[model samples]
Target: MKSVQKIMPDMRHFEPLPDMDDRQFQQWNALLESRTGSTLPLERKTFLVTNLGMRMREIGCRSYDEYFSMLEGMEGLREWNILVDRITVHETRFFRHPMSLDLVKEYVDSKPHDVDTGKISMQVWSVACSTGEEAYSLAMVVDQAFKKRGDESYFGVTATDISPASLNTGRKGIYSERRIKEMDASLRKEYFTPLSQGEYEINEYLRKRICFARMNVLDIDKEPVGKMDIIYCQNLLIYFERSSRHDIVKNMARHLLPGGLLILGSGELLNLDCPELEKINNLRVLAYRRVKEPNKDQN
Candidate 1:
């Protein structure tokens, strides 16, 4: 046999990614905070570097500075969305916080009994809803509450997130077995259709009941939907700076119907004094109720 000539792929094209220095990291951090109201502390620098490096490599960027420059102005809007999806944590599952679900069940159970049958319209807002788990969980709990009480209350969940990709996932309403594994078997059977590869999809009726929209929590004041009976915002405020968190909470409070529930992640906020909201006294979950305005004649 003739001696085969060794053929090797070109190595010159495979340069190592440039390390993101402190200044570059700070620049990206500020940019992220400005655009998304999320903070990346010094300890998360490695995380920032990894996510940025992966995106940069995909786009053949030579340095962090180059990538930063690319993520500016209207031309970078699409890329910025992709980067947001990658950098933002989307780790969530059905009923990830059982206390929060229990609180929601309580809120649903407390609905006035004198309402016209099937005329009780309850709207829920699931902020920072990663995928559809939290939103569907709310829907299931609310629906179960109504069913258990033999009421035909009409309820819907509006799920919002900053990540377009995550919103897309929510719209699809498909989740892996691991996502639903811990959920109660009855809920799984009732709301999901088992699919190939251990995946479950939300039933058509439940999926239709939730409207997933791409929304940045920072721009919540611009929400077009009317005030909601329940605004469930959990596991997201921790990523924001204190001022940003307060602003988000205040704005979200503005969207709550009087006496509506505004639930937050436990310990996510302390002493958040919104004049319109009074904190729920539950030790297991951090929550607030929008205070109904006093009547004009009331002293």
Candidate 2:
């Protein structure tokens, strides 16, 4: 038989947050979907609620209903940014997926050598590039590949993300040691300068080649990023609905140069049927290429 004291639950650690009801959950789901193309399912509402509770406490909202009302208009738009920063996941590192980088290298090796004919060099875009790691990773790879080919021009990388905070970290090009320990040692030495404070700042050669921007996926259609040779948008679309995922990919494809590559996170979208995208299945690698430029008059 269990002891009476053990059987009785301790009253001390049972503090619970205000319960989020169905209507309130729906309101949050809709607002999130409209702003970020992401929907939190019913089962995931607890996670959403926890994050909301933190922000509500910071802003002194007593209830979830009060929080919902505060998330309303022009002023609410500013709050939305803070909310997004809290709720959205931004986990990334240098060469997060090595296989993807390898495939990109193969593609770069296949490109015609730069013959000083004043032809446009390669243009790579690291979409949703959190904290500049991916953008700098691309630069390092491209720089080494171009050098091995006896080519000297270091192509630029355009990195974009929805979180201004993430973009700000990326623009600084400084990273902690723990953040980069998994990176190749040789590459780390070659591309970064160690600081007295024990942080490593990306070398000027790689740093100057990247341009960071804050962009929401919904507004991508309006931006003229024009004709990228490689557009790497990985580990991002999983947060959105399947229909929205397809739309984002289609929009991204519009900016690809004819026959240029568009690489997504593995298994991100299966059986993708975009008319302009031709899926490439190569040696356990999944990627797509623009079949041809969309006609000027057609979207």
Q: Give the lowest summed-lDDT range of ten residues in model 1.
A: 112-121
**Backbone clashes per model, in order?**
0, 0
Q: Please provide TM-scores, in order, for all candidate models, with all chains considered together.
A: 0.92, 0.88
Residue 219 shift from truth in candidate 1, angstroms: 0.8
Q: lDDT per residue, candidate 2, 1-299, as tens digits?
A: 97666476543323456788898899888888888888888989878988888787776676887777777888887887778877777899889888989878887888775566644378999998977889998988888888777754558899998887889899999999999998889999999899977799999888888999878888889997867889998889888889889999999988887778999998788778888889887656668988964575244
lDDT of 1 by residue, 94-176 (tens): 78888888988888888775444635678999999988789999999999988887865788899999999999999998988
lDDT of 2 at 161: 88
Native-referenced Cα lDDT, model 2: 0.84
List candidate 2 segments past 4 Å from native. 1-16, 113-120, 293-299
lDDT of 1 at 155: 85
